[model samples]
Target chain A: MSGDIVIEAKGLTKTYGQAVAVDHISFTVGRGEIFGLLGPNGAGKTTTILMLLGLTDISGGQVSVLGFNPAREPLSVKRRVGYLPDTVGFYDQLTAADNLRYTARLIGFRLAEREKRIGEALDRVGLSEFAEHRVGTFSRGMRQRLGLAEILMKGAQIAILDEPTSGLDPHATAELLTIIRRFKTEGVSVLLSSHLLERVQSVCDRVALFSAGRIALMGSVSDLGREVLGSGYVVDIEAEGSGLGERLALVPGVNRVEQTGIGKLRLHADRDVRPEAAAEVVAQHGRLKFLGVQEPSLEAIYTHYFAARPDGTLKEGARHAA
Target chain B: MRREGSAFNGLGVVMLKELADHLTSIRFIILEIIVMLIAVGTVYVATQQIKDTVAQDPFLFLKFFTTSRAPLPSFIFWLSLLVPVMAIGLAFDSVNGEYNRRTLSRILSQPIYRDALLFGKFLAGLMTLAIALLVLWLLVIGLGLLFIGIPPGGEEVARAFVFLLVTLIYAGVWLALGLLFSIVFRSAATAALATLGLWLFFYVIWPVLAGEISQIIVPPDPRYMALGLQTPGTVVLEQFLARLSPSTLFGEIVVAILDPTTRALGPIYLSQLQGAVLGAPLPLGASVLIAWPQIVGLIATSIILFVIGYVVFQRQEVRA
Candidate 1:
């Protein structure tokens, strides 16, 4: 409903026969944000994306993209959003230029501007050299780049990329992420879905960890660390004397106090409480050594949320952060 | 916020792409060659028949071009058999092949509706068949002038043109059948095989099987067989069942074109031709109009098949 909201879905659900794909879930992506939907395979990420694109019928709820209902107003939503599906295929016999030209014409671009726009799009994706070659002969990375080029040609306010860097090498992945970042700087909102946590962590400002057909956690990277992992800190200390473990556990908001080996305590405490716990430890045991606190990584949070799944099988609403 | 006819626009865009692909593809080239082969082969076979008839009786020249028989050597007869096969082969894989190649989803993503793809392909296939038919007719007329030493009369040319139109409709019937098969079958090869199987059933197997049933039902009353003894061709027991086949309808259209005195079948040839003159051209317009139902049936069948394909395509999900 707001200008900043690029995508809004409320109670969206899809079922094929008896199997529920995406079930009663809601989320929103604000403008100029790299929002990732993190889920493993068959977690309904693709189904949710398809429903948002108006390509699949939804059994329940509603979806609005760019302030238009994708089901009833797909054309409008499609016009404002560029989508790079997991894989993009082209007319195998046609040259890349011809393919792009055809796509341009289909989308109602004027013939006069087609050549120029296609050239610019290819250049943007670093695929200008392969413009005249048949797309069938293209490598996997080249096809991915071309798919990005097609999306760029849409000139959309929002981009929905479903695993954009799925099959790419490290170099290609970095290239695609850089292009996505450039779009972000240009004020385009991005909704990317991927199982690759590292890729999502690097490119996204915020992420939704999907599990059991819902967002288990959703928020910005740092917000998640500070809020969920308590300022991203963990303390592991080696006690020098008796009763050090019990003394550390007595601290307020100390989550866990574990004894590792002879006179060692690994303390899991909130970041704010860590300083106090350490102060108390130093006061009581002067011979204490190996006292340190490590910041929690995105990987750690991802695993924590994934491990907390009640059914032990991650669902679509598995995104967790913030 | 602004959703104005993007699906319609997508359809148009997709149609243009599909038409271009069809026109330039190897499949079209191969189909064209196959059609040419059929036309040439028919012409060659007919020339041999004409030469043998002429050699048997030099005085039968007047009856050669005009006859009231059920089957004759007119251009229409040859067209009836060849055109349907051509149409079937050209279109059988049109839609299913795209699905098989995983190109339908990709193509659909480009601002086009499903209707455009089906309609565009249908129009293109018809156009291709029209071109082939026109060339074949020209070749036939050219050969007739070269070998017969007589330029065709106005009525002859009119009849020939009407026959060409009939052939076009016959081809349309097959195109519709092919499109239907394409929609029903997922693989292009399977679609093609299904169309061929249908063709074989209607053209060859069904009629023969029906003959046995009809004979058993009506026990070949000696009276009926005796009455038909004077008929030029053998009246098989399956004659009634055979009439339901498309091949039969097409054959009737051909006979109507060649036979001037072909009136209501109940009357004997002697009475039917009582008022008709020898070597006169029949009213071609009246004959086509008489067979209008069959022509319309073929056209309607084609449209229905295409509509089914269109609906199926639009409803299908496009995966990456």
Candidate 2:
């Protein structure tokens, strides 16, 4: 990812009568970066994406895709940004290629270029073999892949995917993540929204955690985990000795220590205190049974952040909007 | 808010794509078959009946569309009903089908505005109806030629062509209604049922309701009832209420266009008809002039319905 920004939103808002679907929120996606919008089902992730795509009106604030304002210059923004809506649908009666042809025509691609682009896109998504098959016969995973192929066919500078891997199996999720990674390598900035945190965590360079029309947190997963989980590293130590937690707390860079069980101690530290904590345990005449530094997982951060909030309940009407 | 590009940027592509879908759809084929069978039956009956009375009728081609040979009404009578059904069939699922398929947002996310999608689908629906109606129109003309063994005068052909155009506009009104219902109702079945129900109310129930309403509005005069003569105000009120339906307007237009001897649509005094020949065919222009208000009424209804659908669609959220 470069220092150049591809998407920027400031004080973005969407309100429907008395209900606020997406309250004032701000975020940016840099070139060639993968930005995830992670939240629960009714958390306004989809509404924000729609606003950026200019599919819905932005009630307040500004959003720019590349350099053009999505609201006022949607054609220019849309021409360069490809969007895969939630459960992205295709014409069931049309063959996969025929469906792409319709999109290609809409994109104003000429005949020869359209066919070439469609073939290349299908091949890249591993849907080349099914190009002649009607989309109705495709499985859920294949439909998602076809949606990616549409983005690929557009040769868009930025791909905005909404719940791209919602219903995919583990194997399909891995395959889709690989394809998304390809977009990053190709220097196409990607902003994908998904509720599957851990599954998409590996690919996102940064994410905005949405809750009830507002972004509660935004940053890289590890950075968020550090801020939310209150530690850069979690060192767990297991040994048969009394006051093992006290000994680990004395280790350099270790901030807090908690005795989890009869022979277990967990340490929250600034660095990997595993080696030092292990040595400290042995010096205390304790047999070191286990010592491992736990990498902060996105699920842990998300769960921890929500659990700590006093009023994190999602609004009912936001569910209908998103 | 000034948009960067033309709102109609992708209109042709969307229209052609939707047009292809409409033409190849199984539902469209089934509708065409039923309309064809009805057209053939009516024209065959009309041709059979016209054979004996073919001696003096100047507009023999027009007779094929209006002549009833027992058990079956004239081609126009069947057409007035068939046009709406075919129109409703083509459009009842147009917008909602996209919602059900979950394809509306994906299509709108393309480099085009919502204007293109809505108007394109509408134009495509009208074009689909036009294709079928044109084919049916030519078939009747061809059958009239084959059975009557006489070429229709230019005036007869022109008047029949005007009838064809008026019927197309009438179809547009129902198409717009169906499209509106499709947008207003999410379920395709509900859209179809609502549109068909409205059509039934207008075609079958509304006229009867109008008669009752008009009588109430202009109470029956005992003196006129005893003489078996209707009160003037009651008849005018009844016709006015019935004309509110597109069906009545379509029927009136077809009547004026096909039968040129009909001089006036509304009530005319005896003094007004004294100078006119009893059975002389009016010029094509005169016939069109007579049906002009009804034709304009049909077009206006379609535009109003389409505008309503367009406004609703514009404000509607693009997500399923």
Candidate 3:
């Protein structure tokens, strides 16, 4: 709800040997917002996340988490930041309660405080009943919940999760989104990076689109949709004659056109030109069986921005295109 | 900010948790079972041998007991040799496994320092080795009493106690070595392999190979070689090659415990030791005094290795 920044990075870069994994990228997440870092695989999203948590070295640039420099003040910064790695990798031999208890103790929680926190966190993540079970025997979703339980036990002000819902089922993913939503309501700023755009869009208030090592486009979901397409509609049409409306719909900036039947067509075109196109279709071809406008999904917008780069890198040029 | 005392509390927490981890770990369980089996098998075989030997010639006991001052039941000798191997096995994966499991990052993220992590692991390892050693010692003493019917003299007790101290310190060296290897090598399997390789090299392979090298380096003259070659060659060659091994340093300590008449040569007079077979097998006090440097060297080596590990761990990157 507030515009206050929880994490801020400027010209952040990380390079391993000859390859630059995360180029000089910059972004900020506001307080209490679920900020998603959306990118395809090998896009440096995880690298950027690590840099924010002070887990990885910063080859160049500066980063501050909760107003403390992550490099110089890692302990202080880490005190208020909880990180969930890609795979979770809990101590498989330890019971969930034991694992959480161990982590809680490490973060300097009082024994009494940790006891309560452990119980509450496990309950919140819906693993309360399975707290006594070894993590090795837990299902993937249960392990994820335990990982969340560990993070929540720390009582961190910010949560940085890398691909938290990657392997979860639809039900588990929904449960995870609910937990993240609850954290957001409690004023915990979350930085979630995943290749799942729909999941990110559902949980996040804002998103930073990453490609290669750079952030290509960053803004609210609606704002990015508006900026990229300026109100585009995906129109599906059914005609009687030669599907000529679908062929003529291939003007510059017109995204795509597909024939659904002998005369039916699906049109992805600019909003301002849709009425003009439809009018021409009526005059030139025939009567239309159906014509409607639908909002552009995040998938369509993501493709429109990412597909331009031959290498699929979302750098400055692709950012401008978006 | 929270108080500073909590940081140490965090360390205590890790220590306790690791202790539990060790208790429940299959590695520790399997090691305990193996060590107990070896100790029981060894003591049983030794008891049977001593009984049969005494029956053959009752006076043989007098010769065995009086000729060498090394306080026996000879169980001490076997115990010393076996303890280090067991200790190394228990600790070889302490740090390396954490790296492999990727749990080090999660654990270190807590308010504890790298030093505390190493210290906690080392302490836990020492405790485990001590416990195992304790069980073996008790069993050895009990078996000795059953067969020999001697409760052991004050000198015997003193020597056994000193031997235990040496065993603990020796085990510390291995624990430290394993930890250092873990830190240097990221993979647990690689660290385990490297540690076993080093153990084999130092304990078995090195001594044999060094003996062969010594023979080639200082071969016997044909005129003097045949009649008394084994005696003079063994004396000169062992002294020279033993100096190359920490195990040799330990072997000297063991010899001094059993035979307390040999006098220890000082550092300045180490050269004088070339042709001289140690006279008046050194007193236990004198052996410890002379071997203090070697003992300290092993301990210091351990400390230095762990310190390097700590530094590497502190600088490593932990991903989210």
Candidate 4:
């Protein structure tokens, strides 16, 4: 990305009475980037989205979307943005096509173009077959897909989806993720929130982890893993010999060593210890059966971040990970 | 260029959608059927009685609305009793129903202003009520012409037209009340029950309460008992208290417009009536002039209630 900012928030703070929902948070989303807001429930993720859309009044701070101040020019901003709320709602009596038609009309689509756009949107979300069915009869996954179809019909330049895969089966979730990926190809910026770290790790180009109404960690999945878990790699070695743990521990960069089986050793090192550990085992006259490097997963990084401190504050080293 | 008033960008769409829904809903259809049956049935009975009296009555067409048969009431009375029920039914869920369905936030998130949603709902309800009243008015007029075999004069038509307008204004008051309750309450059932409760209180219990309050405030003097005349102060106080209810105001306007012989709604001096003919019908303009205060009261009440709903709805958060 060329750093062409599409959304910017500076000192964005929201307080409902004495409780601070969002406090002095700032972030920017680049054009055509899929930015994931990863947070547990009540971490202020939904509040931040509402503030960006101007659906709720800001207690204090500034936000701009598409170069228009959302607080002052909400209609102009809203016209260019699409929002799928956490609990997407539709008129139960109306069919899927009718619901999309209502939204198209509200967005000021003319009659001639509305029908074509609705068709294209429904087809994109894989809901073309159920277009004539009332939404009340739809499953949770179908309704979520219908919401995506509505956003598509609007042709919104910016799409903000909250908990998009919530209440969906594994297959439905995979289908939704694929559709979300297409938004980037079309050059539409997407900001989606989810509590499922695995889902976010799979699709997000960059993510901000929210904890206690603050961004505790933010970066690409690999960068976050390295920052929170330390600059290290695990090398697993299987050798049909004795004394391999002592031999691997003598390697200069190896941090720790563990035995898996009678002839297995797991080496934690800050650098690529695979070559050194393999050569050392061979030198010891041991038959090296298997040797592999294990990179830290996002789940480990998340657990490390939370388990690292009691105050829910990010460690100093992880602050600059973004 | 974009429209000058973008705040109301989606107003027409919302209004048209709501109006279509109201017209097609089962609740509105059932209410329309019941109201029409009662109105037509009473007018039919009144027509039978008026047939024998038409030879002597000059304003026989106006009698279609004001004349009563032995067991049934007049056409205007049935309208006065049923129009509020229809108006309340149409709007009691206008705002809260959207919340219950979880569509309020989604709709507000569109490019439209919050004002547009409430305004469109109120306007749509008023339009539906107006259309129903127009149809009922035409049906009665058509039946009158068929039974009496005489076309109404221009003056009679003008008077009836003004009466129809006044009736619509009266219905607007209740529609506004229903909308206000809808905005104040979160549940559709609670808003509906609250509106209906207010309606019943005003329609059935208010007159008796107003009379009792007036008697306590301005007691009748024993000095005038032998003359068998009501005290002017007590009567005025009672009428003023009763006018607080929209139904009372509507009833007064109906009487003045439909019954042209009604010289005044308040006290009339003996000197003012000396040269006036006893049975002469007032001109359409004069009747409207006499009931002008009542008409203004109905309109002012509707506007007041609408403003309250607008303010409350604007301040509300769209989270729910």
Flag regions of model 1 displaced more than 4 Å.
A1-3, A222-231, A234-300, A312-322, B1-12, B41-85, B146-149, B216-219, B222-244, B258-261, B264-280
Per-prediction DockQ? 0.32, 0.73, 0.31, 0.50
Better of 1 and 2 by DockQ: 2
The best candidate in terms of TM-score:
2
- Model 2 over residues A226-296: C-alpha lDDT tens digits? 89998589888889887777777888899999888888888988988777887888888998888888868
Q: Candidate 3, TM-score vs. the true structure?
A: 0.80
**2 against 3, candidate with superior lDDT:** 2
- After TM-score superposition, the amount by which residue A255's alpha carbon in candidate 2 deviates from its true location, in angstroms, is 5.6
Docking quality category of candidate 4 according to DockQ thresholds: medium
For residue B204, give model 1's deviation from the true position in Å: 1.6
Total backbone clashes of candidate 3, pairs 3 or more residues apart or in separate chains = 9
Error of 2 at B45 (Å): 1.2
Using all chains and alpha carbons, the TM-scores for the candidates as numbered come to: 0.80, 0.93, 0.80, 0.90
Please give the distance, in angstroms, between residue A58's alpha carbon in candidate 2 and its true position after superposition: 1.3
Model 2 docking grade: medium
RMSD of each: 6.5, 3.2, 6.7, 4.4
Docking class for candidate 3: acceptable
Judging by TM-score, tell me the better candidate of 3 and 4. 4
lDDT of 2 by residue, B110-140 (tens): 9999889989999999999999999999998
Report lDDT (Cα) of residue B117, candidate 2: 92
